[model samples]
Target: MAFENPSREKIKELLQQSDTVAVVGLSDNPLRTSHSVSQAMQQKGYRIIPVNPNATEILGEKSYPSLRDIPEPIDIVNVFRRSEFTPAIAEEAVAVKAKALWFQLGVYNEEAAAIAARAGLQVIMDRCIKVEDSILIPSGKTKK
Candidate 1:
């Protein structure tokens, strides 16, 4: 399946409109990109739901093992897992009705992205949420 990259404008609009993001494969270690990015988003007024089998808690939020486990709606499923594994993850993300799928830097699954896109979900690959937040917010004005 072929999928077009989401336009810059659509990406910006999604980022601005979303508040809760599910960080799939999130780790407990603060040094990890998953942890740091989630923390950054949290500070920026976005609720970060940590999804990992290894972690019981992270950033003061309860961690779920999968998108299906999240009781509340997830605006974005920010994937930190390997690119090869994203198809199943994308399927789960779709089944759970997440509004979008985000793959962190170095993570890109064109197949999975297409599946999500075909399901009417916004798809962003190889972009950092922290970077997006920082770039979108004006200097000296915190989003949170």
Candidate 2:
């Protein structure tokens, strides 16, 4: 069976309910798409955890080398890496017990989606999290 992402309403609800997003491949450079998108999400009140091995910190949050290293619960695992790398990330997300796995625009992998889905993770592929939040949750605040 082909992989399908969650519905718009489901995604909206996920975005509303989620509090922490662990950004895999987040960059310290402001010019990068990962950095800009993560910054916007941070401004939207969600706690952004950077998961870049190279950077010690990004967007004022401490950076972890991998998902397994994050000490706190991760509501979402947002990935900015290539499609080929996502399957491993999905495995890590599942291992970390993240609620959702999101692949940024231009990043999509059927294997990764299947892995996360099988583990009961809400999988979103080839979509921009920042755009989704701006459109779905225009208020930029998670519902309490």
Candidate 3:
């Protein structure tokens, strides 16, 4: 079956309920899209956990080399890596019990989506989380 992203309403709901976002492939460079988007989310009250092997930190949050390395519960696994890299990330997200698996704009992989979906994770692909948040929750998410 062809994969479909969740409805905008569902996306909005997820954004509203989720608090901690683990950004995989998040870059240490401020100019990178991952860094900028994560920074924006952090400003909007989401806790952004940076997951990058090469960096010690990004956006002032300590970076983990992989999803399994993060010690806290993750509400969302927002991926900035390429499509080819996502299936492994999906597996890791499942292992870590992430609430959602989000593939950033231009990143899509059927295998990854299926893996996450089978694990009961809300899966979103080929869309920008930052853009979605800005449109769906322009006022920003409320603190729980």
Candidate 4:
């Protein structure tokens, strides 16, 4: 079956409730989409955790080599890697008990989404978290 993104309302709820996002494949370069998007989200009050093996720091936060390396609780696992690489990340996200698994635009995997969903995690694919935040969350209040 094809992968579908969660509803806008659900997205808004996730964004509003999520405080910390672990950005996988985040880059140190400002030109990268992950860097810019993560920065924008950080400005909006969501803590951004950079998960990049090659970078020690990004957007003023300490970067970990992988998702499992992060010691703090992660509300969202936002992935910037290609679709082919997301399943492993999804597995790790499930193992880490992330609340949601988000695949950036152009990165979509049905199997990964299924794995996370079965594990009780909300799944978002082929979407940009920053864009969704602006559209779905206007008041910054999460629905209870």
Candidate 5:
């Protein structure tokens, strides 16, 4: 069975209010999907904090090896890992009391979504932050 994400209204609210988003699995390579999406959010004015054990920095923000290491309050936890890894990440997101957990396209995790939901964290799975940001990009700034 499929899991449901927050409604459109909830997503709009979350995006409007989220300021600091921790991007788990963000890669140093700009060519990677995670890097590109994080850049999109950056352009939208959301601070992107990279969380990769191998990365010292990404998108100019200091990178942490784990969610628990991030000292600042995290509004959103965007994951770019495989489905098998999402449950653990979801647990960490819940533990940190994050406002939401987002799993990028191709990384859907029903169980993980349920876990996040149970923890009272908004969950979005199998979606791209970049595409969502594109819709938000104002007319002049966004290309057709």
Candidate 6:
């Protein structure tokens, strides 16, 4: 079966409940989409954990090479990598027991989505977390 994202209400609930977002493939370059989107998420009060082997730090937060490298529990694993790499990231997210797995806009992988879902994690694909937050979060208020 093809993968489908959860309902809007469910997405909103996931956003509301999640606080820490581990951004895979996040770039140190400010102009990159991954950097911009993660910055926006940080502005919305979500702690952005940059997961990129190349970066030491981004947006003032320590960067982990991969999900397994993060010491703390992750609420969401938001991936900015290409679709081809998503399945592996999904597996790592499951290994780390992430609450949800989110693929950024323009990135979609049904296999990865299925894996995450089977692991009992909320799955979001081809959507921008910052955009979703702005739209579904009541009154555009930043999460605390």
lDDT tens readout by residue for model 1, 62-101: 9998899999999999999999999999999999999999
Best of the two (1, 2) by lDDT = 2
Alpha-carbon lDDT, every model: 0.87, 0.96, 0.96, 0.91, 0.86, 0.92
Output the TM-score of candidate 3.
0.99
Candidate 5 stretches with Cα past 4 Å from truth are: 136-144
Q: Model 3's lDDT to the true fold?
A: 0.96
The count of residue-pair clashes in candidate 3 stands at 0
lDDT of each residue in 1-144, candidate 2, tens digit only = 887788999999999999999999999999999999999999999999999999998999999999999999999999999999999999999999999999999999999999999999999999999999999999889447
The residue pairs found clashing in candidate 4 are: none
TM-score of each: 0.92, 0.98, 0.99, 0.94, 0.91, 0.95
Better of 1 and 4 by lDDT: 4
Cα RMSD, model 2: 0.9
Clashes of each: 0, 0, 0, 0, 0, 0
Off by over 4 Å in 1: 1-3, 139-144
Predicted structure 5: clash tally: 0
For candidate 2, which ten residues in a row score worst on lDDT?
135-144
Deviation (Å) of 94 in candidate 6: 0.2
Candidate scoring better on TM-score of 2 and 5: 2
User: What shift in Å separates residue 131 of candidate 6 from its native position after superposition?
Assistant: 0.7
- Candidate 4 per-residue C-alpha lDDT over 59-92 given as tens digits, one digit per residue, 9 for 90 to 100: 9999999999999999999999999998899999
Candidate 1 worst ten-residue window by lDDT: 135-144
What tens-digit string does per-residue lDDT give for candidate 5 at 1-144?
Answer: 578777767777777778889999999998998988898788777889999999888888999999999998999999999999999999999999999999999999888998899999999888887776566544313221
Candidate 6 regions with alpha-carbon error over 4 angstroms: 138-144
**Candidate 1 local Cα displacement, residue 47, angstroms:** 0.2
Candidate 1 local accuracy as lDDT?
0.87
